[model samples]
Target: MSAAPLTYTPLDPSGFEELAAARPDVVIPIEQTPAWIGFERALGRTPLGIWAYRDAAGTLVATASFVHVTRRFRESVVVINGPVWFAERTPAAERLLMDTVREQFREHPAVDPLYVRMQVATPQAPATGPIEHGWYEREIVVDLTPGEAELLRSFRPNARNSIRRAQRNGVEVKHIPREEWKEVFATQLFPIMQETAARDGFQAFDSSYYETLLTVLGDHLRLLVAYRDGTALSWLITTEYRGYSVYYFAGSTLEARSTFAPYLLLWEAFRVLKAAGNTACGLTGIASENYPGLANVTTFKRNFSKNVVVVPTTYDIPLDPVRYTAVASILAARRKAPAAARAAARRATGLARRVGRGRGAVGASRHS
Candidate 1:
């Protein structure tokens, strides 16, 4: 017998939850969830469409959520790992997903977008090696299927011993409830994030982002705090996606470094997520080679497993090449502005320091 026909139709969040409930293995980030799209819409983006692919038996096999991104009057329909499939990760299934979305974009004039950007978020590595295709191009995943001892056994001695030492020093990890998320953000997490960004030379978002995330994600958002002697030392922000938990954000106070609270905080998070039945805990994106801090973070992650995976780069399917290229170029240029400014500031400071030293030497000669 021939295979059943596959067809795509609009699906709501309820339908998505129903299907996802049946297929627990289809773990996708909360951002891809329909509720998240709704939150985005409430915050001003146009939600273009939502769809589900079903077999002839009328069972939903895959689901997708689409949102229209408009900047300076230019627009694009973002797929963002939509059409999440419950079927095996076969080429045909992936092909159908791409083909269906492309065909829809072609036939529908109302959904006209310069290009469709699909952010890949799968465990399976893409056929393409590495290119630019993600909000973050690389990430780390820790196996949580094994028991605590087995999981700890996989860690390098440094990470393992640090965690043990932190515990021995009376570091305690606790969950911060939603009501107190704002308080923790303002009082503890914010200052540490500022310190981290300054030391690492990265831009840090204000506490409002965490506030909105906590308000929207509700049960899916998990905040873990590492404390000692009544003082909060470090905190980690995580989200419970389909089958995995994502390590979204984290920071530690300067004093906490000596106690290694950050390492124990991670181990505590892994334990909680594993006990909650997640198959693995994704460390999310670490720095790439191009970034100076990548080495330190890469080594930190490798201490857990050498099995670090580089996910498929984000794919941009363009309908209007000229417009797409124009917009892409502008966005890329804007992204580089911050780094350029930092470099310029450093050069100016160095020049001023040299001039000060030269003047001081002449004044000393005059005194002699």
Candidate 2:
């Protein structure tokens, strides 16, 4: 018999969940989940979804969900960690899926997006296909299959020592229950997040964004906080699905640095997630050439595991090349502004210190 033809159809959250459930071996990204779609909706992003299936067998083979965003009258569709394939994925199929999505979006009356940007998030290695890869990144995956002793042995000496120190210092890691999520975020998580952002010179999402994530993802998401002497020192938010967990978001206090709470916090996360039946935990998006600003956090993550994986880079399908270029340039500048500003501030401070020292030297010479 001839093979069943591939068919494309509109997909809803329930349909996407069914496809995810059917594919056990594939690592379906947390960002591609139905809960994430709900979170995006809560954040006011319009959703666009599609699925590819076998016509004869009615089996889902692929799924992609995108958020339609408009800024300054320029529209864009963004797919983060998605356009996932459940079956054998060929370059041709990948091209076809993207082509179909582009056509659908173009035909839709409500949307006239300048481009569609898809950031590859999969267990597969980087592709050598027509999808011109950009924004390359490194991700570290910790194998939770090993015993605690073996796990500890895999880490860098500093990480191992820090974990031990935190333990000795009486740092306690707590898994916040669902009922306490609202209270926890309002009182603890959001405040710590703001402080981290201010110290690190990055923007933090609003409280509602996290609240929606915690509420919608429910059991799939775990918020683990490290406490020292009854004071919250560090926190990690991880999402679990199909025996895998993603180290999603985190924040640490200055006390966490001195107390080594972050190290113990991650170690505890590994134990808790492993005990919850997860085989691996992904310390998502480490520092890379494309994202050098993450160097500090990357140093911290490398302490735990060296099982680095190269994820496929993002690709853009420009519907209107001219407008896409214009808008892309604007967006890129907007993204870099904060980093540039921080660098400028540092330079200014250094110059001020040098001038002060020069004046002091002249004053010492006059006294002499």
Candidate 3:
């Protein structure tokens, strides 16, 4: 007996829902495509997506998209995120699709040093050697399977205390209606984002991008806002996918710190997902050690959730050796420059503050 031949094609928008239905166990949601499309639209670019199908059978088996990002170091890299496929497909099929995608890029003169970065939701790790990259540990999990009481008991004592304190302080959690909340988001959230970005030396999504996402995803998107004494304190944006809820984006006002509003917000999200029959609550990308005070955050999330999943940083599969080396060199330089600039800025600010205080004291003595 021989296996059926496979055919590769470009994925059409109409087939997205059916494809999503075929792979319920996979986390690649229908909205992910639209969300990527939205990102391309906002950025004014078109990303290449490759879909694998059985020859002439017309039934889709696997799908992957390649997004090309031009780095500051002048390197052209492609990231392939959320690659979804039927469980029945063999490892050979996945390899074939990847090879085809690489060849397609090679034919393009402008698409030099094509790199493939993937984060699969499946538990089974794919075999390596086709790409020059190392695999870090990754995970896909379900939390609601344990039930709510068990979930609460798993949490760290401080996390449980924070949640209880928020509830005791009369913190209210509610879904912000898309229409009414858009205006508040623009006014209240944008400034905080701008300040945070400036302080941290990173860029954030433009206000319009978030607005577009809300309109596109509709009910599948949920905005959990926490309030105390009629004042907005903290909020989190979650997306429901395949019987699981992912806590994607979050923000908080400084006033919320004292009341521990985020703890209640997360707890409410967990309760809502459990009631809706969702099997898991994904506490999306938490740093194990990098960010300041993030260990505390990681501990907090782990208390209510048993799965402390550490997903790999994206893996790069370089198609062109010369181009890949050039890009890597440039990225190393770009990262170093930022740290140098931040250190210089801190020293300059310290000197200016000292000079200003000295001048002010001398003038005050002269006046006296």
Highest TM-score among the candidates is held by which one? 2
Two-way lDDT contest, 1 vs 2, winner: 2
**Model 3: lDDT of residue 132:** 30
lDDT of 2 by residue, 1-368 (tens): 43434667876767766766777788888777777777788778887755554434776667777788776747778777876777667665565555666676778788888777775443222222212233337888999999889988999999999999999999999988889997898798899999999999889999888888888788688999999888888998999988989899899999899989999999999998988899999998778866778888889989888899987677677776666667667767886999999999999999999999999999999999
| By TM-score: ranked, best first | 2, 1, 3
The lDDT-based order of candidates, best leading, equals 2, 1, 3
Q: Which candidate leads the pack in lDDT?
A: 2
Give candidate 2 misplaced runs (Cα > 4 Å). 1-6, 53-61, 120-136, 329-368
TM-score of 2: 0.82
Listed in order, each prediction's TM-score against the native is 0.78, 0.82, 0.74
* Model 3 pairs whose backbones collide: 155-303, 155-304, 156-303
Can you list the residue pairs that collide in candidate 1?
Answer: 64-83, 133-313, 133-314
User: Of the candidates numbered 2 and 3, which has the greater TM-score value?
Assistant: 2
lDDT of each: 0.74, 0.79, 0.64
